[model samples]
Target: MPRHRQSLQLTRLKKAGIRSAAMLTLLTGVSGGLYLADNKADQEAASAEALFAEQELTEASVNGWSQHNVLERKVKAEQEAAIAAAAAAEEARKKAASTTSRKSRPGVTVKIPASCNEYSGNRAIGCALLLEAGFTLSDMANCLEPLWTKESGWNHTSSNGGSGAYGIPQALPGSKMAAYGDDWKTNPATQVKWGLSYIKSRYGTPCNAWATFQSKGWY
Candidate 1:
């Protein structure tokens, strides 16, 4: 951490009424305005989450349907790790590097179909394999799986709530799907392929943007 970063962290510690290396690093990487205010919001949301998570747990569901709370818990641990990395290196290499968004450890974990025109379930299987390979991030299921649940409900044919964002990651304008494949709506593999690429290019990992969402409620 640079002197400025250290100073900022201390200041945030005072204002947010919490002290954790993870929160500090995440706050600093926000790349937005309303620093103290945003972090305060993040803290408020976290507190709310802690209060309601147990009640929110759905043991009644089967087949591991939407284990969002599980996913979120894992993400917090990873975020802490990222912050600790920043902290240990504070004096070793002074200064913030202009908020380089965290990169998706690219790899996927789905089985590849022999051809593109496979069954829809087969496409999903391929996507799972792709995630295991192209975006093989450690402990990232929580960060990504929840948002995917909220976005597309795991439906390959899913479309936007409004703005016409479409498919797995809900790419806005829907036409962005063209960048991946022609039959984006029907092919889960193609949608996931594009989704991972979009996250890597724009938000880094799902965690980076999730941290942003934690702060300001959107990315």
Candidate 2:
């Protein structure tokens, strides 16, 4: 009776040990599978975070480039405007200078008429001297006025370098007028007196001298 009872207890103990080992193996496998799944989820979350950070950096670089381009364009535009303003100012200055040059010369603006009475400055002095020298008004207006105007424009300082002529009557070797007065070179009255005397001696009349000048371009 004792031998049979001991053998049955041993068999029960062996069956219990086998069931415990199987339960432990199942638990280990389930735990390992859960750990692997958790690790995969964490890796996916990290990849998403990295991609978002990279996208943010790219957008920031693009915005910075756009801002730089805008600033560059603004500077270029300002430079162009400054250059245009300088060119316009220079052109205006040149125009003002030309206007001033034209205004300064009174002879260039006043045209001499056939009527000697309307004359001013050097021409008026010549007219008075011609009347005093016994020349008729008709001779003075039609011949002497046109002749002197053509030769020297009544400018006492006028000279022709090629012909060696000078003053109101286009006197050749102008020093010849010094016979009339010491100030012949600068005084319109002295030049007028010398010119009238020369016409009386050589051509006899202003009309005759004018006729010669018209035909030959000189008298």
Candidate 3:
């Protein structure tokens, strides 16, 4: 019986959050049987406090879980920003390299492409050049093509041996092409640019002017 009583007392002390020293002091002042009963009562009160503390701790644990998930979202956002910055840097590098390659290439002149100059030197280049300046290609073929064929056979060097009108899309003074640029005689592009401006200001488009010229033969 004594051994059984000691075991019960130890169990109660463990549950009550009491130390071995406090239980020993209580046992020395009271009979062993009375000590056991008081130990059990204290244990019941401590058990109630422990249940309440456990409930509070469970609530705190839930709060910690919410905080952990929020931190994960922040981490993912930062990672995406880093990836975009890397892609932008790579694109800039490629563009810079392309510019450098163009600059270093041999025999690359900044002058107008052969397509532009080829037509420039042709006596035929004069009228086509001017028409292309303001209006589109369709405007040239529709408006100027037929009229010029009739007027001078698409001749740039055509001159009126009789009426004093000269050149393709002949103005009274073909020298008037000099108004566009100093190189009008040699630069088809400049002459074309001037001619288109003149046509637009005067007849609107070659087609509109052509219509008038067809009816009046002087448009």
Candidate 4:
């Protein structure tokens, strides 16, 4: 081998080494730039995804609040309705009690005279007849006494010109008592007997008849 040829070959080899180093540096720089751009793109995409997720979360929270508010309103309405219904029922009960009080009459206490014979003519006859009609002396004092006193004062011949009601029980037209006797117009005993029968059939008792009379002014 010649010395010059060997020196030329070494120079050529050094030049090739420098070219390879330059090429490696250029490739490394390009790869680094591509990596940085890809990283930036990935960061932007992650930021966008985070923003979308945050927006969805905010919307869900708003919807949840809206549903909760609706539920709260429904519960409040139901509670108010229940309170109103209870108040109405109480008012109705009070009104019913007041009406019942108005419809019923209070009881009265009365004192009886000692004997049927202690009364006057017609009064004594009425007292004796009342006792014979399966009624107590208390019934006469509390019911029959006041009842006949208000009707016809125990007079068999007593007549109402306006209504044609007559006799001790004030039978309308006075002929209704003929079922007991033809002498119902004049005989006090017959009128009393017919009156007692009518009271028993219609009202069951003299006290019941008196209560009806008190309530409606008629029996």
Candidate 5:
């Protein structure tokens, strides 16, 4: 009874110990597999996060560059517009100045008539007009002769075709002598009075008027 029972109990104990060791090994292997799977998942998540960050940075940089380009283009366009406006304004100002200058005083050209001739009546009229104006005709009679001869040949009705000048003094439009008398167009005395006054005001004397006429061909 003792030997058989003892042998059976020993065998049962050995079988129990072997079963426990197998269970522990299986649990250890499962735990190691679980740990490896968890570590791989964590690494994948970290890589995905890094990739997302890189994409965001790239997009932001592209946006910033696009904005800079737009701003630069806008500035360049504004500068070009301003330059064009300034140029236009300058051109307008120059045109206005030119128009004003032309409108203020117009230049006149001189012309002589083929029928012009010396008339003795002019000398008489010039002498009387000079005496009335408090000037001595004897001192300025020589200069007056040549001046009137070249201008109107002492003819009160003398007229210029190019400059529209008329009268003994060749007054432009002939009507300018009307300041002396309403008969300036036909009266030799009136024309002579205006002519003498013009010489006094412009050249101070008939000799000076003659000198200016000789130098410039006009006075």
Candidate 6:
């Protein structure tokens, strides 16, 4: 072989090796750039997903709070209604208690008094007094018959030795009957008037007074 030909071949081989190394460096730089860009894209996608999840949680919290508020309002409304109903019922009970007439109670029958006479004694005077006081029912007379009979035996001047009670109604201190008249100590009519007034005020009716007398031995 000729020396010149061998040297030219060696030089061409060295140039080819240099060109391969330059191509390899260019390809490595491009691969690194592509990898970095892909990583950034993945990070952006993850951030977007996290933001969406947070928004969903916030919306759920708001909705839950709204529902709780509605439930609380409903309970408050119910409580107010119950309070109003109770107050209204109390007012109605008070009005009924004050306005109702005692005479209008059922099973009442008032008695009309017979004329005053020497034979009839204080009975006629007592009947007249009860009639004036609105105790005009037969059943009322029945209740009074037992009540006054136990107290004074229908006697106008009946006296209690132990208690100093006197009169048809057995007025304690006897002077208590003076509210009706000055003749309370002698007049059977005045005593009876004061007696009926007392029974009406304390017991509402003769029947109620009789009930008290039966239970407690006094009206």
Runs off by more than 4 Å, candidate 2: 1-116
The list of candidate 5 runs beyond 4 A from truth reads: 105-219
**Which ranges of candidate 1 are over 4 A from the true structure?**
1-134, 137-139, 216-219
**Cα lDDT of model 1 by residue, 163-195, tens digit:** 788776777877676656666667676677777
CA error at residue 103 for candidate 5, angstroms: 2.7
Among residues 3 or more apart in sequence or in different chains, the pairs in candidate 6 whose N, CA or C atoms overlap within 3 Å are 109-137, 109-138, 110-136, 110-137, 110-138, 111-137
Question: Would you list the C-alpha lDDT of every candidate in the order shown?
Answer: 0.63, 0.84, 0.65, 0.83, 0.78, 0.78
Question: Where is model 6 more than 4 Å wrong at Cα?
Answer: 1-119
Would you estimate the TM-scores of all the predictions? 0.40, 0.47, 0.38, 0.46, 0.46, 0.45
In candidate 4, the residue pairs with backbone N, CA or C atoms under 3 Å apart (3 or more residues apart, or in different chains) clash, namely none
What is the per-residue lDDT of model 5 for residues 32-107, given as tens digits with 9 covering 90 to 100?
Answer: 9899999999999999999999999999999999999999999999999999999999999999997676445322
Query: Which residue ranges in model 3 land beyond 4 Å of their true spot?
Result: 1-132, 182-191
Candidate of highest lDDT? 2
In model 2, the Cα lDDT at residue 211 comes to 94
User: Taking the tens digit of each residue's C-alpha lDDT, what string does model 6 give over 98-148?
Assistant: 556432333222244453232256776666666677776463367876788
lDDT string, candidate 4, 25-124, tens digits: 9999999999999999999999999999999999999999999999999999999999999999999999999767644523211233457756666666
Q: Which of 1 and 2 is ahead in TM-score?
A: 2
Ranking by lDDT: 2, 4, 5, 6, 3, 1
How far in Å is the alpha carbon of 185 misplaced in model 6? Answer: 0.9
lDDT of 2 by residue, 18-56 (tens): 888889989998999899999999999999999999999
- The weakest ten consecutive residues by lDDT in model 3 span 105-114
